[model samples]
Target: MQRAFLPSFLLLSALAAGLNEARAARLVAPATVQDTIVMRLPNRATLTLTVRDAAQLRQLKNYHLDSLTTRLATYITQAEAAAKAGTTNQVTMRFYPDKDQPGQNLPEEIRITAHKPGTDGEKGPTKTQVFLNKKFGIVTTKDGDGHNSFSIGTDGNATANAREDSLKREKRRRSASVELGFDIGLTTLVNSSSTASLQVPSYNNWRSTYINFGLFYVQPLHYTKKSKLAFTIGPEFSGNYIRLTGNDQWVQNGNRTFVETAPDAKQIQQATLYVGTLNLPVMLRLKLKNKEDRTTLSAGIGGFGGTRLTSNIKTEYRLAGTDYNSEDKISGTLNLTPWTYGLQGEIGFHALQLFAKYNMNELFKEGQGPKTHLLTVGLNVLGF
Candidate 1:
């Protein structure tokens, strides 16, 4: 890409003048030295580099700009000396590579047309320019342009291109063919069907943990090109672990299911109800990006419906002979509702994902057990 290298070149030249930019800008402490210097180029352009102090006079000492700054500094000094001596009208320097340039004989020359101090009081060059042709141009170093070693001037769009490229790379790295996610959250019931005679069990808020594990294959249905909106559908194999607090275990007597004192109620530690289901979720996602800044934010809302796969109660017991560590597993559906469905949503930026799910169906069939809706909330810590 063709660019205005001369502008940048002249800018660097002025930077190497060792002028105290900081001292020059102060109003009270006027500098003894001429800190504010200006150079008029033959192409009719003016370049300036302002700083607060001489601390960073050289600017970037190891980069291409530094090399150019040092070269311009040397050239200006020589040109001034030549103008004062009346030795010649101009000074020119041919740059040869530190290595070899196979067949090139005459290297690119930088010419500065010097002028003797006139009665009008001209102090510097009358003209200055870098040659650009088949044979004359500034040589970029082998370590130049982010180690590409072959770029000139600005690739004008380099900044924007870099950001977009990085964003694409991150998206590619985050893509998943099959997503397996785990949910770590707390569970609570709403609108409990508790009566004075048959009170529903109260759960320990902190101890009642709700966990979910799901495997899914996301299929985008309406993701248009260059669009921020997307609709996705996926089938997920899901498992739920709902823990209960207190000394009660699930008991199915005849046609109804309820919590009751177990055979070893005093020895029981924790009880959990486990449920498994196969769900189909349809999600509407809104994705956004700032191409210039290389940033992204995303959020999603979804609904899922599925039928029960399995249900069981797992109880932990503190036994006398053991170190308060004994386990019991009871396998039964316990009159849990056959159908399950819910609303779910998530919001995230970059790598963090947070989600919430609520089940609208009662935990058990009507007239069989307590009627309560399930709600789970937590962070989707791993994959999505």
Candidate 2:
């Protein structure tokens, strides 16, 4: 019993370890420089200041409109620069007081003064700073061309405050992660009446099973927390077995014609097919967070294109349901036609998912007498 259970135990243990590592990676922060705050005075002079994460976003409520504006402008400028440099993952903001501002009814303005992460002559690691002026509603980055930078909002004070609060909340959820993982799954082909003919109804029963394995990479989009994109590549193999039974009589012109020399009934045929496939799957994954911790609701749709590498078929026929009439085994490529397309979906825990796929292509090439399809259900594991 221990010997038989060894493989299952090892596979389960490997799955658990891989999932933990992937989850941990998601918590690590991508490398980035600290953000600086800046504000441009109505007098046209720019002032530099420091406002931490929450403080920076609370301008509409805690700080003067001028102050918040400075920080907001600096924040966005720095964010854009960071993205261009491929250093930061994403940047966002929330403007509050949402209603129109009273004082703003008059011509008033504030702008960013300097751009942070200033262009150091050399083009290597340059540190940018943001200047924030609480007194004047201006924001500037280390890179801005002039003091008339940009305004965070002309909305009501309350709305401005709300916007700042939203920005603070968004900054907290941001993260960058890298993952690596694998999944092993199985698939089976079921027998159906639509695929068989009357003469071979009993002898042409067919069913097949397969084992597949794969690897994947995943990246999440900040605009939508529910979805991510992933690419998976893998190899798979399948074993097909078929059984057929029929009356010893042969049919002619849709008429039941019995052979005088043959017995009333017999086992007509049996066959086995073996094939291998190489697949590349691309998919968009949607995830939902549950109220519970360490658990996530996940689903995805994947499209795969693959080619069959090897396929062989063998068959046996018996007469009168008793004596073997002929037996043949062929190693040549059966008309798997080499191409397959499918869509898959599933729900699962972090890094470990289970999905089912329905192949859209016919099993045989065109002009073949009968038609067939392939269906697969398998476990999908992701690392990211």
lDDT against the true structure, each candidate: 0.54, 0.41
- TM agreement with the true structure for every prediction: 0.51, 0.40
Model 2, poorest ten-residue lDDT window? Answer: 20-29
Model 2 misplacement above 4 A: 1-207, 223-271, 289-293, 314-329, 349-352, 367-369, 381-384
lDDT of 2 by residue, 1-384 (tens): 334433433432332222112111001111331333343333443333222333334442333333333444454456556545664433333233222354432113322112122232212111121212332232222212221222222122322344346444633433333344444454444332243342212333224345555555444443223333343333433333433234332222222211112343544354445556777777676665543433366677777788777765545567464654776566544545668777766778765678787778766555331344666666655433
Q: In the order shown, what is each candidate's alpha-carbon RMSD?
A: 17.0, 20.1
Best by TM-score: 1
Across 261-344, the per-residue lDDT of candidate 1 in tens digits comes to 666535778877777778887777765556453326668898999998888878887865667677778777788899999899
**Top-lDDT candidate index:** 1
